[model samples]
Target: MQRVKAVICYDGTHFSGWQVQPGKRTVQQEMERALTRIHKGEHTPVVSSGRTDSSVHALGQVIHFDTTLAVPEDRWPKALNQLLAPDVQVMETSFVDSSFHARFDAVEKTYRYRVHLTKERDIFRRHYVYFYPYPVRVEDMKQAAPYLTGTHDFSSFCSSRTDVTDMVRTVHEITVEEDGDELHFTFRGSGFLYNMVRIMAGTLLEVGKGLRRPEDMPAVVEAKNRESAGNTAPGHALYLVEVRYE
Candidate 1:
């Protein structure tokens, strides 16, 4: 048997999520189905770098799996794509050491949230962009971002549904960028809790709207309560940009 690693991208609009669930369609299920077919019906399990909620897209999500098949590493993507749906594609593949893990070995991840600065929604991007027509000061949002950087117990920024008790994580950077009629919020961190990025996006949006001051961020982090954060931004606007390993 050999281990293989692959980077994949998917449009999560139709997927229940990345994980397998009874009576639900998921990215894992689809991938494993393709692999199982190639393995002549033997089950092949795949592990991902992390899970993305329903409607959340991925540009460079990573996965690893062990298989008995002797397919060439360079040909794995072509083989997998032929059997998988168009919405999910295997972008690249490589042979990995037996000890390398997709999730545990990941050192950092980057997620980007796209906000369309328009009151009207466009048909082309309705499923990929968050439309917010409200007035927001980009400068205020920039000022609030620094408060969320660095290592901290991100309990307030995490979702109440998150099962992890240790909420402390290092955020290497949080950048808010504006391009034309869209605002792109990029978050790079060692790791992120469930809903952490979304909540932070919402909170920063509030800062831009003048509902909260930039300085209020310090107290919000100190609160360590889920209620202290703002609304959870819609998952459709979030994308798993990349996962880094060392």
Candidate 2:
């Protein structure tokens, strides 16, 4: 069997997320179905670097699968694109070592969350950005971002339902920037807990709005209580920007 790695991009507006559910339509389900057809009814399982939540999009989600078919590596992108829906596309593909597991071998991942701070929301970008009418100080958000970097127990920002025992993870970087009425929060990390990024964004938004002090990040993290953090931001505004591997 040969292993194949593919770069995928998708607009997550209509699907139930990246993973397959019992009856829900999902990105993984669609890709697996397309692969089954391409492999002539052979069931092939595609493993993703991470499973994005419902309504969260992706620009460069990586996935891998093993197959016995002899299709050229260069043909995988075009072939898969032909079978996938317009919203989901296969950007590129390559043959990789059999030991390269998409999830296990991933070294880092980056995600960006966008917020539209305006009185009136843009109809075109409503599906991709979270709209907040309240005023936000982008500089304040930037000032608080550095506190999130480095290894820490992110239990306060993680969803309560997360089953992972260790809440510690290294955040390589956290950047906050603004362009016109759009605010972007980019986070690069070794790994993330369930709803961790969304919670962090929400907490930062509070700081930007002057509702929370920038110095409170340390207290929030040290509390290790989910209630210490702010509400979870909408998943629509979050995008899995990229995944890195060594």
Candidate 3:
């Protein structure tokens, strides 16, 4: 058997999420169905680097699957794209070592949350960006973001329903930038808990609105309570930007 790694990108507007669910349409379900059809009667499961929540898009999501058939790596992308939906496309494919596991081998993940801060939202970009009519002070958001960079117990930023026991994770970087009327929040971390990025974005938005002091980040983090943090931003604004492996 040979292991093949596929890089995928999806719009995520029509699917429930990335994982396969029993009665719901999903990215993994579509990919697995396509693989089953390509392999004729054989069925293969595609393992993704991570699970993205509903309405969250991906730009460089990676997955790996083992197959018995010997197909040229270069043809994988074209063949899969032909079978996959227009919103989901296989960007690239390569032969990987048999021992390489997509989820286990992943070392880092980056996500970007986009917000359009203006009186009127752009009709063309409405599906991708969250529209907030209030004025956002980008400098205030940047000043508050550095406190979240580094290893910390992020229970306050995570969803209350998250079952993960360990809340400590390393945030390599957190950047807030403005492009015209759009505000971008980019976070690079070793791993993330459920709703962590969205909550962080919401907290940063509070700081930008002068509702939260920049110096309060440490205290808020130490609180380790979800209620101490701001509301979770919409999942549609979040994108799985990239995944890195060693």
Once fitted onto the true fold, the runs of candidate 2 whose alpha carbons sit more than 4 angstroms away are none
- Give per-residue lDDT, candidate 1, residue 118: 84
TM-score of each: 0.99, 0.98, 0.97
lDDT, candidate 2, 1-246, per-residue tens? 999999999999998999999999899999999999999999989999999999999999999999898999999999889999898999999999999999999999999999999999799998999999998888888889998888998999899886799999999999998877898999999999999999999999999999998888889889989999999999999999999999
Off by over 4 Å in 3: none
Candidate 2: residue pairs that collide:
none
RMSD to true structure for each model, in Å: 0.7, 0.8, 1.0
Off by over 4 Å in 1: none
**Local accuracy of candidate 3 as per-residue lDDT tens digits, 1-246:** 989999999998888999999999999999999999889958899999988988899999999999887789888999888888899999999999999999989999999999999898789987799889997678888999999889999999998786789999999999998887789999999998889999999999999988998899989999999999998998888999999999
lDDT of 3 at 102: 90
TM-score for candidate 1, please give it: 0.99
At residue 71, candidate 1 shows an lDDT of: 95
Full-model lDDT for every candidate: 0.95, 0.94, 0.91
Best of the two (1, 3) by TM-score: 1
